[model samples]
Target: MKKVLILALLLISTVSFAQTISGKAYYQSKTTVDTDQFGGGEMSEEMKKQIMERMKSFLEKTYILTFSGSESIYKEQEKLEAGSGFGGMGAMMGSFSAGAQYKNLKTNQILEEREFFGKKFLINDTITNLEWEVGKESKQIGQYLAIKATAVKKIDPNDFEMARPRGRRGERGRNRDAEEDSEKVADTTQTESEDPFDQIEIPKQVIVTAWFTPQIPVANGPGEYAGLPGLILELNVERTTILCSKITLNTKETESIEAPNKGEEVTRAEYNKIIKEKMEEMREQFRGRGGRGGGRGRFGGF
Candidate 1:
């Protein structure tokens, strides 16, 4: 009994000490898209450039993740406004936003702040444990030795997030939204054949190549990426590549890291249900407009 008690206390002390080692990692993410798919095959160079330019809002972004031990706070950095001179059509582009993601590996939970239709939501859910295969390959990322690791993830089509569909003008993605309401709601519904997301086509598997350093000793990275032996300095998911631009370790100030509690608390399954319902609601509102039973509504709404 005495030996067991001493061992337990040592383990507890080790955990507490690990939590004190904190750092800030700045990551820049970039994604590429085929223009022909969105532009209907043949298009002039100018048209392709314009489309790609608009897509920069979704394809390219930057984020800062403050982390220590099993906790992390990942948030997108402020972006500068840029777009074509066109009146208001620039707002129709899709957005790629994961919002402020707060993760606690100790509890296997993630609290992500999301916005839709001008409302903010706090999605509280369990962390997804992605199976990663560590490789013998090694590389240097910003003076830190990083080992290569890969994960094959099966993505869900229904999990796709479209940019905010604004009318004629304004910012895309999470650019248009509200702060947070204390009211919390959880969705209680099972996946059915009538699920709207069933219509979306999802790929079977996606390859994720990441480079992490055991030196950092934190299984954290940008977006929903983790499960490595160390901090991920670079990650390639599908067509998007996130690279760590800068890393500042053990700052003079210890930042506070906690779960976001402002919006509704719902599980990942529940959040997916909410998104599907909201999309169906939008579709129903436009049902009468030249589409099957009615008009085309606003042709490219989402």
Candidate 2:
């Protein structure tokens, strides 16, 4: 009877632990944009500074991550409206993907609804288990004490819009099948302008240093990071850093957290394949203006 009682108590505790905890973490992120890299064009210096300022404001924004121990939803906070963008950039006609990401920690599943050039794409994939080396260093992020952790992550070069050349205004998603292009072997003699991804010699890798607090014992984080002992309040991915400003934890877990079932369903790998092809097409448009080695860009993406 003693053993039976002990087993029942253990099971009850486990079930209670699995229950979702309602929590919201606010994060402020900032990234540097090198406008000089895109300069040496016909635009005046004053115009360049104006464009850079706009880009910086766009890059530095606040995000709220509402999560429990098991699932989370990451989205940006709404801000004031701005006048016309520089070259109508980030408009409805623009081509880019910035979407809400929902993840299930226990099942190792993620569903991100991305908007690319007037189309919606659902990226469904299993999270890659990252191996982090926990460190003894500790620092205070706001009120909670945080411990340091580090990891090296491999990044696909094609994932960065800065790495690829963007096409003209109003250009959007290409419906061309990547498999059709993949079936034909790439020409060795000709440059891989149409397939610029092939031109990337090495895959980019970044050192990720994250800080989490054990005060909240949950494997919850922002973006594509998790599996830590506590909530990740601060994350430094390469040159970019996202730091949590505030956190509100409530037991009112009434909201339902579910994976997004909309958009054209595609695995992460397949979606990347489409991006590679589209990037190739964009690169070709650049080559048509002048060869790759020739001139500077008028404007660039971050």
Per-candidate clashes come to 10, 0
- Candidate 2 stretches with Cα past 4 Å from truth are 1-20, 35-48, 79-94, 161-203, 252-254, 289-302
lDDT of 2 by residue, 1-302 (tens): 66446434543453346355678899998765444323223457788788767566456778888886577888878543322364323331235655788988778898888766456889999876676777779999899999898888877665643342222111233432452253233433123332333322323666788998877766668887876677889998744789999998877654566667789988887777777676555566556655343222222332
TM-score of each: 0.72, 0.70
Q: Best candidate per TM-score, number?
A: 1
lDDT of each: 0.63, 0.64
lDDT of 2 at 109: 90
**Residue 42 local lDDT, model 1:** 47
Residue 138 in model 1: lDDT:
98
